[model samples]
Target: MLDRRKILTIGGVAGAASVMPLARLAHGDSTENGVRNATSHHHHGGKVTTRSVAANAAPPLDPFSVPMPVPQVLRPSYRTSKLDQYVLDIQPANVEIFPGFKTAALTYGGTFVGPTILATEGRAIQIKYRNRLKEDANVHLHGGHNPASSDGHPMDVIPAGGSKVYTYPNRQPGATLWYHDHVHHLEAEHVFRGLHGFYLLKGYDEARLNLPSGEYDVPIMLRYGKFDEDGQILFSPYDDVSTRTTFLVNGRPQPYFKVAARRYRFRLLNASNHGDFKVNLGGREMVQIASDGGLLPAPVSRKEVLITPGERAEVVVDFSDVPVGSSVVLESEWGPVMRFDVDRRGFDTGGPPAVLRPNPTLPKPTVEREIRMQLSDDQQVFWINGKPFDPDRVDVRIKRGTTEVWRIYNDDSDWGIDHNFHLHMVRFRVLDRDGAPPWPGESGLKDTVSVPPGTSVRVQATFGEHLGRFVYHCHMMEHSGPFQMMAQMEIVQ
Candidate 1:
């Protein structure tokens, strides 16, 4: 059987690495071992991390034997003054996830992690997604404040061989957001099979700040996995998330990342189905500058960052302070999953940002709601407010431009699995957790907030101006999908 050991080769013997081709380096620069040298400001490093809890597992391969794969940003097929347009062919592909192995998977433009889409804030983006997969599929710009038609509502889908265009105004602040499959009952399976990607909305005015722009700003997607003997991704959502003992950094297990000696901003997205990742750079301090809703009002220094599934955290680390040839291992709850080796002398341009972006002013709370999340007695169905998802049933109705407070509770003590809440089309500030002030680590505006068993999380947000229906539910795909733990809300004018 292809146990976790057969796929992941963790840790490596310290050594200097040679350079790879400029093109491959541009698209993640996966040089075999150690960080490869880049010709320009780009580093051999990528935005990456992994998750797993199997500490006793042995490995068939050496650790950090592959370079971290930074997903390439998809280029617009054509550009217009009003918007940048692109096309994505959603189809099946055999991706090489393990050494000498090809895993059956689906992809957007033929990559496991799907190509990233970079959009400019305030500039519109149009993506014509052509579904070539065997089943119906739809694109959800998770966390995007898009029109109802483009928000990827659970009921809206494109049949096989069909296509649809999703338009995003990108009128919000720069944030680390993402896109993924949003088909109703099949969401978890599709995402697990690889139908997710990053969608970074960059602020037009941020160029004045000079904060790790260009290659230095990396988007790393973190995930956990279980594989079959043939190295194919095991589609199991009901299994204990901890049973997935293989940590994969952007789909590759225990890869190496080459970083420049200058400060770098990493946008980390926890893309796992149920696993929450606790990652750190071997105790070195990392300053978190942003989260799901974009730049924070100020930086929050932390020793470790815990990100639940569907959440994002942006942090900056200065490698200049470390010895040039020395390497730092990225440690997780399961131990080292990736290595960051300082391979080159980098030119540092950005310093610690005194103030990042400003927070949006929301209307005073005029509505209040309590959301109770729990699984049925049989654990065969997940529910929000004691009911499964019903697209036509609007569970919440909030007047537009008015703020609301939601006290979300996890009532599954017997099951005692971690669950998170995600609301589409709006962003909010977490006010408190379990009736106490939120921890300093949960400072930024977010669309998703983790709610551990027996805990209650309160958040406030003003409804979007758009008059339409949206959904809010546990971000655990299985819980929200076939188990139907999601519910609909309407923004009424």
Candidate 2:
């Protein structure tokens, strides 16, 4: 079940000698005032996708709920630089969204997503990260706790017009983090050829959780691209089944913002690299007060909310009742990507905070443990327990705060390949999928889950209570970095 010619061949996008294979697997162009040419390369391609979880027939305790209305916007600003960026051949012409089909995407700075670094938790960001595209870049800031050489270390590169001033000194607190291009094997074609960005991390309890501040607060940032008709950017080779038609919230595409119905405050971010957003609200009703480490002690009004690509939700949409012009959309999973028009002018009735301060939910765990995740694709050595990702080795370990019951299975029906299981630092509680239990608007709390392939999910957490070393990989950012699928959680103390 593992030996597709030995699998593990990192760095792709040969598309016709277009080259950019992570800049020949990280050679060196160096930037950020140091290290000029170190070429190194020795991680040996990359390949891991195993499968094995067959208990079947236990699905349906209460799974089926969709309805999200909480819509709000306004809170995005980025335009900082020190130039010299260029990864390789370079791309990014000029686009806002919806033109001829191939929907604009080629970022490093021209935004598909690549700028939004507002920091202040511990302070010490530094940044110089340049790497203008073509190949070989490194930024990684997903959750950002920083360390491990400023984190982005897969093969770590800035080559191709090099740059790297990393720094990272903002230890926790504020949230909604992001920053991609974790180059290993060309991180899913440089994050679908758009890289990525959006790393806000303020602090002081999100400015005292007043909630909707400055323009009502907004940071949508969803993503999904698949262009090619002379538009340039079009990369996908982890198992290309291609299910993206075209969607992008912050990078525009179906974009159309113009709200004013009042109470807005949406910080939903499903930066899709492999797609899995069920987000709903064509009719409107979103409340969801926080996720991914922030707020939520009360406030849950769903219409649809599934976000799972590194995850993050913090809804609060109250459009008052819609009258001005009536137009409020914001769906994903393919169905009307971004719209918000409420016009009619002025209004603010208030209806969003029954309570939401720092409620990361906690009250159901006597000790549990169940992990049944399955996903297969014979010929190419892809697995989870069947074997593939072997970074030297360290499969699984836990002991810090102990609390288990993590079951996830997606028997890849031959070649469905589209995972995203991220765990790192703990955050679980799905409870059932093929056995039922999961509808208090999804019982709350989650780190990342998009199992779709065959289906047999199950979860319930408690992992050593965050000691350090963490990671639960497969967010499909190209098979979870370097297509190895990823896995790691050492919390032993």
Candidate 3:
């Protein structure tokens, strides 16, 4: 527990939202969820319970002025023959994000950007998470095949001053999974306060390929934020992101990183609340070696990688031929995000034979289903198929050894809201998007897919292993929180 007077905590709106599709409706924000799925007419505007207003600032920042801070790979507290043990303290810290301002935030393991946790493929692992916050905290290993007991169910919380040890079977293949807070309604607020980290699995197909390792391998988190005059991070949950123009990489604005003139493997995760990234290496081509579920069957060459919120893409960039002291800036639509400085002479030990592994196929579909991601006309309640989240209700039930193809749609796209679909416990193969084939880079196994406004996505998934309660929802926290657009499916024998 933190000493009462030690950590300086910043106060924020208790139950505000992050992205409101109708930016104009933000003026009237409140604590009421409004007759929850009931028909409208409770018209009280933002004047009712509005909080302090801050500036929509684009801080004056120099491109490449600061060197990117690399997160250290956390060493386990101890290890036995079966599994590794780790302790994560969820608490508050004042981190220096901007050049001269220290942003007070909630962190995991004391890192503004949560540090990476490495585990071996197919080996069991135990993580003891301690909640030092005033509220609840739990870790959801995104992209992991964890059992329902350890899957970070929103209500399976480690309350303030409490602790729990979650054990993962690690029975799935090696993939670039992540850990983030998944507390029911406060997900948006908690994650925005910085509770995310990389959890990568090694020793599977990726091991045979001998991909870039050691210093050459990097994990970078990308997101957008809005700050106030004194460099304090601002959170206006009611606003529809019209003011969040400042993009950041690993919590810094346009920082530069020193990389060797050799092949490097960069694992990229989109940790933002609602932003999608169009990653480009300044016109240079890179190969996509992995997606949300890890190493692809074969490398796909691409000029840009499109990744959405809650998705991960791992690419290998070869700078062995570039001249020393030269730099290539990584840019998105908002301009320079980070710069990679190649200032050293190094050998390029090309990785993995042309082919790393074969693409595994899923069993034929034995069941089919559809769910609509929607919102009420008043926009106060979010729901799936006209109903908000009800933890007591089992929306759908599936037999343990069956495959299902889900037709997920963004039904509220009429309001210009973009949503994506995510399933817990198992990774699925995307069949297509809107009856057409998915992008070449998205062909690999994934647990999340973007269902654009007014469109639908088809995916084939199998629930052959774990049996218990799991959830499917719009990974966008705003919709998941205030809108309540999520449902549960139980796996039974």
Candidate 4:
């Protein structure tokens, strides 16, 4: 077994010296600490001696050869009249990620990717989260409609060995949501360490639609990671850069799922820290039934879906015509992600509904906001509207329950890459992208949208009952930090 103390020391050393300098520059602070630390910073808000790890000492772990393991859906320990409660402990463990190779990883509930939380609309959820690791962390229910207190604001951190109860009033419609670490300056490192899980909200409207259920409904989470010679996870401390090489679906690398010759509902989430997947289903047409927020008005067929970090899409694939002994591979631009082996035949009575859900009528905009995403000339820093994330600064303030149009511009042409725009607590509709109507998959409600370089996208939303301070930022975790592309908003009465 690898020495826990030694690994901690090595991680600290590798992060502190190399990563902290950029972070300090971003935050305008001399020192800070969390899970990923540098020589100038500490860990879990404690002082620790730091050293440097030789980058050339270890060989990189092979991305292939590990059979995929399907993630297990988490069952709540108990339920009450008004609350569904769960307990999660964040800690470190060693698992066989590669064949016969024990890779050290940080996990939630003692798994590589945390357990999936199945929730229902109108039911409140109370999660008692305990941090047993050696660093500070907190949980963010991404794409949730809840009070700011439970929004996992970066400033609202849980220190090492600390615990907190996060409440989510599941009042929104059925959607594919997720939870992960959201520490202010260390979100990238914490998430890259495997602190993410799915939170699927089931609603009466969706349940009544008679979509695929039980084993036919699958949740696929895509992520990438890097491993060292000793099979330990390695996180880069560089600015605007990541070291992801392996692709995983629901915590498994190139895993294959056995499916029946019928239609299957796949809830797809792009959970990578900084990568995007332009997924192609081996030339098979995928019917996209929903986007981030919920069901679309009608199902749209598409050949490919470009899912970036922090975005989710609900797609259905009909395999009724495939031979029983056939195999279908899902591929990204790089290579195959996973496979579906037709092992059985079953009657699929349900198909995509002609009409899914009624679109909410958005009131006239009472406020118009413009936000810009820019990268420094050197591409070392990211900024929002010419300003980096300032905890003390409130970028926008508005009256609660009012509709607004936010025009987000991605001005990062220096690197010629796209940036993702995301907001907390409320869902929005894509008014247009670059003056064109929203694409098929983007027509539904959404909390996150992709903004390509040199383009602007306009979105409209009504700020609902939840009031207080919330955030709007890039979904690329590495692009969100103390001095990165993020801003705060206040909803006033």
Candidate 5:
């Protein structure tokens, strides 16, 4: 085993230029227009500076090179009010990713990837989080409908060696939510070092649907990162655009899972710092039962599901007819994600119900706003509506319980690149995309939506009971963090 103490002592290097050229050298892919302007104005004291560089790429690890390791399903060690209480210790440790390669990692509860927290609706949850690393960190329950105190605002951070207790009134319906580090400026680096996990919320109505359960339910957390020759994780402390050469599912590279010939439910979470996935299953149709918000009115069948970072989608796959001993692979544009081996025969009694939930009634709009996404000429700074993030400034003021339409446009000039929009504390409905009705996959409620290059997306939402301050920004970590694409909104009664 690798020495955990030694690896934890090694600090991460700062600056984007230090690791920019390595991606081109390793992948030979010139498509990525890396940070063209290496000099950032935000450097302390306004002095032009750079960090000493090092080799940041390891030999490419082929997918399915090793058998898949199913992540251990975590049952909360404590619970109350039908809500689970977990004590997560965030610290640095070394994990054996490949057979012989021990990679340095920052984990929750000493695991490379944090354990899944299964929650039920109408309950209350309390998480006692302890930050043991050298840097500040905080937890954000993505897609949660909690008060400002428990929402993981960037400014609400716990210093190293400090602890905090977060309370969540689990009032939202069943959805595939996740938890990750959300410290203001260091979110990219903290998440890149492996500070993310799954939070699955169950509802009484959803349980009645009779979807796949027990052994058939699986949580697939997708992540991407690069490693050094010595197996240490390499990341650009100042750049969010650094390329990742390795892809993983539940912390393993190219793993395969053994499945019975029956219907299975897969809860997918895109937890990468960057990169989006266009997922398909060997040309097999997948029934999408829920998106970021929760269950749709009915299951939507489609050939592909496009999932961006910080997004979640719950899908069901029927393997009843697949021959035993046959293998099927789940793939994305990058390459094969993971393989599924049908090794056992079993009876499949569960199928997608015709109706999953009632469609929400959108109220008439009381206000409308437009937000334009752009990049600075030097491409070092990202802007939302021609302004950067200012914690002291509130860009928009909204009335509680009123409906509003937010028009988000991704400037076409930034071609070949797409941006995603995410709003905290509320689930929304996509009114239209590029003036057309939302695609089948986007018809349901969502907390995040893809704003493709040159296109505009209109979303409507009726602010719920909670009223305070929240944020809306691009989901691209690089853009939202160092580049400043985030903005604040105030909710008034």
Candidate 6:
């Protein structure tokens, strides 16, 4: 999701700051201290330390493989919920990371990020989720291959104490996805409060990538969370809504990992509630191998990759030359993410693959169309195409497997709001920016891209082959509420 909560600034009030607290609107279960619902922080510290410490060290674990020793792990299940409650308090607490600083996070399972839901493509996933907080809530699977019933339809509230089961068949190939609250009125609050987790879809194609195996690739989710002076987590209230200052990688505030000094593959997910991140390995560059939908034609070597909320990148970093005790920091232009401390141990690692599986590119859009998006602000209303969202209306439709170009013009002329455009079903290649080719990092296929104020972007992609009701909209939770800032796409057979 992209357009976060929009802050309303009221000016010219005499001694307004000294006035008594206005009657706080009842949002579910707000703390007496007056907290508002807000999206969680994105990241902090340095880049991940998943590289090897030596050229001949044992490799890292493969996130795709579920070990036999832990075979009893829960298989994917189905469930649901209805928006009922409000004011949920998620704790962004600390956890041990061997020699690293205790990481802090807003979590439902006491971890920075939740566990992964392993599933086979083309199957049903049912989730019966409950909202224990004092406000309404909902959940959207970041990139689930499913139907509308499971897509967390906007404004479909799961009231506090209420529950809803999301049921949709998984139809896409292997990829790293995520799920988080998508409540219409209080999305920022719920997600910022830690109601998100990772969801993985495994398929036969990924098995053929030949990039890394058994103990070489890992899924590392990067997010940020905040805490209060009282040692409890600090969440955004409707009034004080904005991104936090601190950053986090995989739920840790500032953690480090030990490496054997070999080549390691990392699947990076920018799960931040509302932060634009340019991931860089301290002073070094990265070989970006894949993006949202899966592997690219081959690795694209670049120094920095700017990942927005709900975006993912697959990259390989070689740490075989770093000396023991020397540490490498994974950082972004925004803040440091995490550290990789190379150990004396070493191992012979496999080199980068020359030919990776590439998505079959369809012919250019035979039916050319343009979408002009505007992030305008009125007294309290936000819009797309100068109109609010209305479920009665089906925004766009396309035939299965047809390619098209979506030109998004961010007309923040009046309001100039930063908007993140997220589309469902197929991933898209950023064709150009201001009519020119995009940067290397921006050239890959993606599910979400931020349309900064006063700028425009064009994306080319095909629709899923399945017939169903899918959606495309601004990911900013607050901007996308009832009757405002959202649209739908129906794929016909």
Number of the predicted model whose lDDT against the real structure is largest: 1
lDDT for 344 in candidate 4 is 92
Candidate of highest TM-score: 3
Model 3, residue 490: distance off in Å is: 1.0
Error of 5 at 399 (Å): 1.7
Q: Report how far residue 416 has shifted in candidate 6, in Å.
A: 5.2
What value does the lDDT take at residue 23 in candidate 1?
A: 15
Q: Which has the higher lDDT value, candidate number 1 or candidate number 4?
A: 1
Candidate lDDT (C-alpha), each: 0.76, 0.56, 0.75, 0.75, 0.74, 0.57
Q: Which tens-of-lDDT digit does each residue in 264-302 have in candidate 2?
A: 777888776654566688656888876665455567888
The digit string of per-residue lDDT tens for model 5 on 1-493 reads: 2132111111011222111111112221221211122221112233433333332455445556666665565766686556677787888888876667888888877777787787888888888999999989999899999888888888889899999999888888889898888888888788888888888888779767889988888889876666776667887734333235466778876678999999999988888766666689978989999899989889999779878788888899998989999988887654567789999997867587899987688889988999898765545566788888898999999988899999999873322346789999999999899889997778788998888667899999988878788888887776687668899988888
Tens-digit lDDT track for model 3 on 1-493? 3221111010011112222222223333321111001111111232333334332454466668878887767888988899899888999989877777788888998887887888888788898999999998888999888888899988788999999998888887777889899989888788888888889888566656878988888888987666676667776445435345566788776689998888999999888877677789988988888889877778888899878789999899998888999999887643567889999998866555778556677788988998888765555666787788988999999999799999998885445456788899988888888889988778778998887768898998888688899888888776676557788999999
Pairs that clash in candidate 1: 9-63, 25-29, 47-220
Pairs of residues clashing in candidate 4: 15-37, 15-38, 16-37, 16-38, 16-39, 17-38, 17-39
Which regions of candidate 1 deviate over 4 angstroms? Answer: 1-59
Clashes of each: 3, 47, 5, 7, 3, 87
Sort the candidates on TM-score, descending order.
3, 1, 5, 4, 6, 2
lDDT of 4 by residue, 251-328 (tens): 665667888999999999988766677788888999999889989988989899988789998999999989998988
Q: On a 0 to 100 scale, what is the lDDT of residue 482 in model 6?
A: 31
Query: What does candidate 1 score in Cα RMSD to the true structure?
Result: 10.3
lDDT of 4: 0.75
Measured on C-alpha atoms, candidate 5 has an lDDT of 0.74
User: Compared to the true structure, candidate 5 yields what TM-score?
Assistant: 0.86
Model 4, position 234: C-alpha lDDT score: 79
